[model samples]
Target: MEKIIIIGAGLVGSLQALYLAKKGHTVEVYERRNDIRKQKLVAGRSINLALSNRGWKALKRVGINTVVEKTAIPMYGRIIHDTEGNTTYQPYGLEKEAIYSVSRGGLNQLLIEEADKLENVSFFFEHRCLDIDVESNTIIFENDTREIEVKGDRIFATDGAFSAIRARLQKRDRFNYQQFYLPHGYKELTIPAGENGSFLIEKNALHIWPRGNYMLIALGNNDGSFTCTLFFPFEGEYSFESLKTEDEIDNFFKNVFPDAYELIPNLSKEYQENPTASLVTVRCEPWNYEDKVLLMGDASHAIVPFYGQGMNSGFEDCSIFDDILEDNNLDFNKAIPEFAKTRKKDADAISELALRNFIEMRDLVADESFLLRKKIEKKIFEKHPNKWMPLYSQVTFSHIPYSEALNNGLKQEKIMDKIMAKPNIESLWDSQEVEDEILSLSANA
Candidate 1:
């Protein structure tokens, strides 16, 4: 078996290590942070991730989905909170359909442990990759007091959005790269379980406090604590930059997300302590340097977390690359080229979908007209499930190509725009006339 080198022991890197190791290769996963399994904070975790069908499929391929399922909490719909603390529940799909909420740190550690079961899989903690020589396939890593150079037959860079490996490759001629950051940033907060580990709010739904320009969402953990995140603008009249003092922060939460503010007793403290992380979308061309080095996951196409596909899409990359390798007889020359070319468009599609979803989640979810549109769409979907799949369902519930989903969504959007433009659309959204219009448009789609 060929020796392989993988960078970044985050979720994608760890899962990729598991996949490659099971292929009977000597796989070394190099991570910058110390082993999370050994960390005290990793005992519980931070920012819980939403694992949809894509993520579940990848994990199941590695034979660990069952274990993951045990720790996951199923969220069948979105429980949207209005300014007055009233909630509107919107089911994500028909009965028994749901997305899962899983702890990022716990999942990563589990993946690492499972991969460690294979004697060929090894992890080098605290070894940060500094640079790489794409020509010779040699990587230099700083470990403690020394720098170590390693040469492997194949190298996979799963080192997140700001990857050290990708940074080095960006210096090459003819390489294309673009990075864009949203005006908003996210800060993670927590709502601990009640005195007896009881959920303070609805446990089976993803809770959202949609406030037009910004929003706050919460996902529950098996430990009964809810991992909450606030997506706020970095600069504005009411933004993170303006909320400087503790009073300003607390008062902001009280007036904006009163219900959530009451639930999170440590809101001000968490707001003060947690750093606000920026959201970025990364797009690049030719996610590989010939067949020697390949970039997967966020290293290639990092997207915003608005659609909750950042981790899912990255996990999907591992699965797709694995398939390409198998189909090409485990030859890097054949597999890498195909994946780089074929996966680029899908990654780009999801990036756009994610940004669009941000607006829908933060603004449209609370609008009356948007609600009417949703009701009409849902009615259409129920009547003709085969003919119409909502864009969100298509992205989250199926393995349909992201490019196809985006294209189809665009068609549906045009049709819906036409329908919504009709006079008194809000009053007649459920009328047969509206249904016929949607049916005619979707039939072509």
Candidate 2:
């Protein structure tokens, strides 16, 4: 068995450990933070993540899906709130398909506990990775008291967006890397459970207040509370910077998200208390360094959370890497390079999709034309299931490669644009003429 060193015990790191340990490798996971399972998670930093099909497929492969599922609250659709305090419901898919909301810290803890149960898996918490020698297969890590060097046959860095390992690799010759930070920043707030622990809003759907420039989203938690995240520009007329005083915060929410403002009693306090965190998109190439080390998850392709696929994509990395290992007969030298080459395009595709979805989520979700497009797309997909799959479904519900999904989605967009341009398209969205046009366009394209 190989001696494998995995860095960063976050979602991807912990899950990767489980996969490697199951393959009979001796795995050591070094985390920079304290063991989350043993500590109280700081309030404002715990962003809830959406666990969709890609994430489930990974956990299911390791037989830990049930445990993770227990903590997830199924969000069937988006419950959109209008400025007038009105509401609209948009189902994510045709059937009862839903994305599960799981707390980031909670999921990480569960995965860590599961990994610990395996004799081959070991975890070292509070061990910050300082640097690495990729050619020598050596890593230097610093704890509270000392810096130590360790050697392993192979190393995997899942250390997240700001990976020290990736940083070190960037200093090397011919390593390609790019990082982009969105002007928008996010802050977490909460809507506590009501009397006797009941949800104040719709429990089974993701709630969104999509203003043109910014938005607020809430996902249900098992504790009968909802974790609400406000995504806004760091500076602007209606940005986080504009809301300085309690009264400004109050007035902003009351005018924009009055209903949510009422539900969150401590809105202003949480606004003041929570730190506004920046959103970054990371893209890099040659994720592996001569079989000595490989970058997985956010370390390789960190993306904005708009697609709700950051964790899902990371989890999928483990699954895809496992397939590469199997295909190459467990040869690291062959599998590592193949994994990087095969996965990079998909990573880039998802990164672009995530950015596009941010616009859909924050602006287009409320637009009448966008809603009409969605309805027409759903109708086309329902009639021609084999021929048409909505881009969202392709990304969220199926394991179709992200590159294919993006290509197909763009094609579908062009087709839909033509269909929507026909006279009286709104009234004829469900007409046979519309279906025939879509089918013909799809076939021709």
Each candidate's clash count: 0, 0
The global Cα lDDT (0 to 1) of model 2 is 0.92
lDDT of 1 by residue, 1-445 (tens): 8999999999999999999998899999999989989965531238788999999999999999999998899999999998889998999987788999898888888999999889999899999999998888899999997999999999999999999988998899988999999999999998889878888999999999998899999999887889898899999999999998989988888899989988988778878888999998999988999888899999999999989999999999999999999999998889998999999999999999999999999999988878887888888888899999888889999999999999999998898889989999878888888898789877876
Residue 96 alpha-carbon offset, candidate 1, angstroms = 1.2
Stretches off by above 4 angstroms in model 1 are 42-45
Best by TM-score: 2
TM-score of each: 0.97, 0.98
Q: Write the per-residue lDDT of candidate 2 for residues 1-445, one digit (tens) a residue.
A: 9999999999999999999999999999999999989977653247788999999999999999999888788999999999999999999997779999888988999999999999999899999999998889999999998999999999999999999999999999899999999999999999988888788899999999999888999998877788999999999898888897999999989988989989988888889988989999999988989878999999999999999999999999999999999999999889888998899999999999999999999999999988999998888788778999999999999999999999999999999899878989879988888889899999998
Question: After TM-score superposition, what is the CA distance of residue 216 in candidate 2 from its true location, in Å?
Answer: 0.4
